[model samples]
Target: MTTRSDPVPRTVPPGMADGSSGGTVPARRRRRQGGERSMVWLYVSTLVLGIGLWWLASALGDNALAPTPMEVVAAFGEGVRDGWLLDHTLASLGRVLVGFVLGVALAILAGFLMGWYRLGRGLLEPWVQFFRTVPPLALIPLVIVFLGIGESAKVFVIFLAAFLSCVIATFQGVRNVDLTYLNAARVLGAKDGTIFLRVVIPASMPYIFVGMRVALGSAWATLVAAELLAAPTGLGRMMQAAQQFLQTDRIVVGILMIGALGFLMDRLLLVAERRLTSWQEVR
Candidate 1:
């Protein structure tokens, strides 16, 4: 048997045919590496410039008020060797951890309820608004009176910071959930709990993450302020002591360490968020 046959040739786009677009993946990856290197160089250059300025000033005026960069670095080394820096660092971070977890847990629970249930919002939002507007420092006197200048006071202040920020975030995240998906879930006869757990919670995670990050910054700042007023030991306590002694090198070292540690903590949160939401589509 014989059959008629027709043949057609198809052409693929030029760059795509070679499994590479205008820029091959390897080339783009190289460009990305170059950019990262440039950024690293820029950061290093700025740090060097700052150190140079400080060094030049110290050499010329023989100033005692401001320590040179090298002096601060040396002080940091000494503090580490003496266990003073490490102990204080751990204490401060521990306070933040306990406080932050308590606050975040409460906020997440309350925020979800408030966002989902109208009655909960009506009941709690007024108080939330009132506290949100008030400065954490202003409440120090009251907190001291109630809880004293102990671990409780420090943790209490940090918890308040984390709570207010997280609640706001949770409320907004719930409100911002896609209405269409919610409706579809409802149409499918999904229970309120199921819809919330499956759809709304997942949808609002990005915003929740954003809020958590902001709250962490607030937690650190608030804890430092609380400790500055009165703490047996911590970074803030050490910093206050340094100020009294006019140990400019130790002060500078403490400040730099705080900033570095805070930076690291934020990066850790970011890593957790990325791992938790690996299945999520980027918005």
Candidate 2:
């Protein structure tokens, strides 16, 4: 038999044998680094441009109605120095956190039941649909009457907002799981519990996360409106108090603070989704 010289060794590059691919690894790393840097710059540029536009708008409008960015910054600093801002921020944040957690937990349970069981869907969906149509803010008066104008009242309104948004999304998510997957698992001799835990839950997780994000937004929106219910200390209360004296800068600070907090929370949720769902396909 003719001895065949090892073709693989000849064809493979010197560095590729060791997985470096003749320095392509470093080049790819550099490109990735460059892309990350570009993203950072793009984000910074957009933020700066927005601030510039806001500054221009303030300069062109009545200062009383539209305070300058500098004025807003000064107000923010003063609030921080007085420590009242921190208190209000914490109070508002606490209510949102509590309401969001409760809403999401109950929503996931109810949604899973409704999506998986015919009787649960028939019994619960009509109520869910009815309440979802009614805005959470509209229920504030009833909530206050029953729960009193206390923390529970505010949290209840926020809970409604979060629950309605989340339950619907989660319900759809669970319902949308591909039947083929279920059949395949069944054919492979997987039991109902195994299929549910291994297939249904993982498949529905994306939808759950999406619902959570929506619920978080709803919770924040409801928080401001909820805090309007005789709250002694909250960003929403602070804004309302400032509005009486036309303190536009303070109002702007509250708006900015809410936006910042919401953005940060959303980003955190996104990071969690990415880490947990790394195996899922993405566009």
Candidate 3:
């Protein structure tokens, strides 16, 4: 039997020769580590400064305006143990989620129709523009009158907030689809529906995701305001109640919780965006 010739070994790149190689000094790894360390120190400094200021402020007599961090932490613990915080947080989250889903879904459908059909766009664009100009909170009274001061009214406010932001984004995304790509697909005998699903939507996905991020923020804001106004339960209600009793600690706790939750939601959305748009973004 004849022996086959072995393939040549691939040459190692220039950065691998020295003991101090790219693996040991990776730019990306260094940057990430540096960033994490910086963030940690920044947060620690902020906490220290905040605590010191609060201590000084309390000594000067104004706990109402600047309660200590420890007080806030204790209140948070109390609220958690007593189910005050969790109940409200969960209720607010539920409304936000339902409204956000409905709004985004409707926005996507409306965006597709507006983008693909000129007659539809002409008919609906004016109405959309008018509604978009009107703030969701501005519709609070009208919604309360129409839907009552129930869950539906609160959710409707959040829905409108999310819908307006997302619809504009989706419409822009669809319109931003490359004409050449659509033409190529059409030449290949692709129907409008096929082109929309395969080409237009994929191209618009990045923008839609951007819209989702914005809509989530808008939804959160609207939910809080709506809940503060009329809801029987929610973080906003907790804060409002705290204000009524002048419980600065509870108010602080609510504010902190909202901030933390918003931060987490934003991070989650960013992760989703990165995963979904990996093809378009650099690895």
- Report the number of the highest-TM-score candidate: 2
Q: Which stretches in model 2 have alpha-carbon errors above 4 Å? A: 1-37
Rank ordering of all candidates by lDDT, starting from the highest: 2, 1, 3
Cα lDDT for residue 265, candidate 2:
99
Please name the candidate that would achieve the greatest lDDT relative to the true structure: 2
Q: For candidate 2, lDDT tens digit of each residue in 80-152? A: 9999899999999999999999999999999999998999999999999999999989888788779999999
1-283 in candidate 3: lDDT tens per residue? 9786998787766666554465554565587679979988998899889778877778788445667777888888998899878998999889988999999899888887888789979988999999998999999889888988888898889998988988888889999998999999999999999998999988888888888889988998776788966678898998898889888888888788777787788889888887777668443
The TM-score measured for candidate 1 stands at 0.83
- Each model's total of backbone clashes: 0, 0, 0
**What TM-score would each prediction reach against the true structure?**
0.83, 0.88, 0.82
Candidate 3 segments whose C-alpha is farther than 4 A from its true place: 1-65
lDDT of the candidates, in the order given: 0.86, 0.92, 0.85
- Candidate 2 local Cα displacement, residue 169, angstroms: 1.1
Candidate 1 lDDT over 126-201, as tens digits, reads: 9999999998889999999999878998999999999998999999999889899999999999998999999999
**Deviation (Å) of 236 in candidate 1:** 0.4
